[model samples]
Target chain A: MTDPREAGFVGRRSDGSLIRRPLSPHLQVYDMAQMTSALSIMHRITGVIWSAGTLLLVWWLMAAATGEAAFAAVQWFLGSFLGLLLLFGLTAAGWYHTLAGIRHLMWDAGRGFDLPSVYATGRAVLIGTAVLTVLTWVLLLLFWN
Target chain B: MADGKTVHEAALRTPLGRVRGLGSAKSGTHHWWMQRVTSLALLPLTLWFVISLIGLAGASYAETLAFIGAPVNAVLLLALIAATFHHMAAGLQVVVEDYVRGELRRKGLILLIQGGSALMALASAFAVLRIALAS
Candidate 1:
């Protein structure tokens, strides 16, 4: 019933009792320390990662179009340790985002709403992301010319 | 503070009343719908592109260029590019709107993302076309 905008708001809270006002899901009360929360936040984080990584793709494409020397330079960097690490991270992020996207689509269709199914699908997305990432690297190593 | 049943009921705003002139351009439904549509479109396109890349893994620079220069691959590449930037812009707009509290900065970021996406899409398409036609 008390608001900070009101003059007696502080007086009401002086007793250190919880306020009797409607509250939204906020940082102090609703702690997001669960698997579902982790997966949900990871979706946004990975989306940002791979979305930025698209610039790297753009650079690679532009280099390829530029000339042999340009392409060679980009290729050399991509083959280096740092470049490989960056690629690995981007690959993982892209995989996670894609898998999470599938889950989102499934949810859009009114599927997987139960608690057990939600956890199961979240786990599935994580495992799928990891498997796809490793498979991508393995394929690259085995078949890269 | 007379915050009782009558006052609250009288004060409750309708959905449209709340939305109108409440800083919304009213195109959020389109943005949300497009996000889902783009996400759906990316599924097969990305898988196809990834498999294609794997197949190209054993190629030289010229061979890679030749693959991209092919009519079918070039067209598919163009579609992937368009869908990607489109999805990226829409997704980032949601992210920015969620976290960025400053109105000026949020608006600036939205503009930057949309504008940057357009430019990058154009550049990628041009590069792909140049490779495909120059071959």
Candidate 2:
């Protein structure tokens, strides 16, 4: 009689250990060779964050529509430290998503696909997002009274 | 006769014969096409939104509301809200697919995103209408 463990389905490695499948490809192996891929991924990331951030927008709108008391409650929430942190994060995500979207539009229009140009544009997107976010916050602080 | 039968012959065919021109399932193409279309529409709408917000800067709540209540502004605001939520739903679908590996979890996320976006879009439209229609 054939032993159950000797079936072809039950296998072992040369060293007498159970064999395992290789791991799936992940971020560690992600190639940074293309600007479009980077921007596309970043856009999705920002989109996800922005989706969640819409809760704040809804809160503000609903409060404003309800009454001054509700509005004040939202204002209080927005003025707190935690609120400021969330706002900063949302601002950064927005700037990054928008600038990267512009880059994507350019590529979609048949421009800036060369190797050197792609890398240069990717760097520009990163710097532009940072600059825009800083400028936005500065203007908000200086003018939003 | 059995020895002569090939694997192809063993396959079953229904009354809806091979000649019946049943096409591929193409429901997803509409979602893909609409997302791109809305993205293009939003390119201009978003720019207009930024400009409008800038012009309304430093204005009081009443002033801002009045500005948004103007005919052109009201129409544009509605369009922006609709397009934005549609685009957002599409984007969130991709994000859900990427992050949620389990079948049930992925379906749940998709349903949540779709339902949430639809509700938000309707609510925003109602709010805009209220502001626009207030006498």
Candidate 3:
């Protein structure tokens, strides 16, 4: 019997290399099947957003260290419309990442792996992030007033 | 004499074969450890940061400088910056590895995140030192 690996090949190149083999297990063709999949994807997405936010944190720290004029510039930007939008997004990402991290910790400890519990907790995490983000902003506004 | 095994077979064999302690990548422990460590550190540091920001808000530049120039404030500020950046770097590295599939791209992004955080931390520390030492 012909070897399985060699059965499909018509011929080899002059240099004796196998020609144009198909790559297996393409990611583009796979479907996200459940809530867990969605959360896993979002976890990575929020991570990038959090990374960008860290730069802002550093900027704030450096500004605080500098004198009045420099610090004022940082304040002005933060208080502006665009800055507010970014801050809002960052806040949401922060809460989302925090909640997700807790969920992962639970999984690591071998809890919440069952279907019903996983789905329930996943939904809770999604809703919790939004609620926490809004509450944070509300608290900020109330206290800052 | 036994027939010579192929290259793949040779690679599979070892002096301590089968019973050796060699195992899969164990870096998960490191990641888990750092995440918890940073989270613990950030709990207090973050609270201090928010309170400090709120207190300093709307204050004049000189007054703010004076507040930071205080030894205790300066030291705390430095510690917070260091811990925060380190935590951020670790978090970003995981992000890059998860999303960036290509080996070069993933490694490059991780390096950029780490390097950027380091630079920012250094710059912030220098500025803090300047304010603390200035008359």
lDDT of 3 by residue, A1-145 (tens): 1233222323345875445332332335446776777787777678668767877876765786765677889879988999889988988987787788778778878899999998998999999989988987776776563
Model 1 C-alpha lDDT per residue in residues A25-130, reported as the tens digit of each score: 2234444788887788889889999888888778778877888888788878878999889989988998999999999999999999999999999999999999
Segments of candidate 2 deviating more than 4 angstroms: A1-28, A31-40, B1-25, B51-59
Q: Model 2: clashing residue pairs?
A: none
- lDDT for A72 (candidate 2): 71
Better of 1 and 2 by DockQ: 1
Query: lDDT tens string, model 1, B60-113?
Result: 789879988999999999989999999999988888876565568878999999
Q: What residue pairs clash in candidate 1, if any at all? A: none
TM-score of each: 0.83, 0.73, 0.71
Q: In candidate 2, what are the lDDT values of residues B13-122, reduced to their tens digit?
A: 55554445342333536776687788788878876875565465455666756776788988998998899899899888866765555668778989998999999988
Model 1 stretches astray by more than 4 angstroms = A1-30, B1-24
Superpose all Cα atoms of candidate 2 onto the true structure and report the RMSD in Å to 1 decimal: 8.6
> How well does candidate 3 score on lDDT at residue A121?
89
Q: Candidates' DockQ values?
A: 0.39, 0.19, 0.26
Record all residue pairs in model 3 with backbone atoms less than 3 Å apart, i.e. clashing.
none
- Alpha-carbon error at B110 in model 2, in Å? 1.0
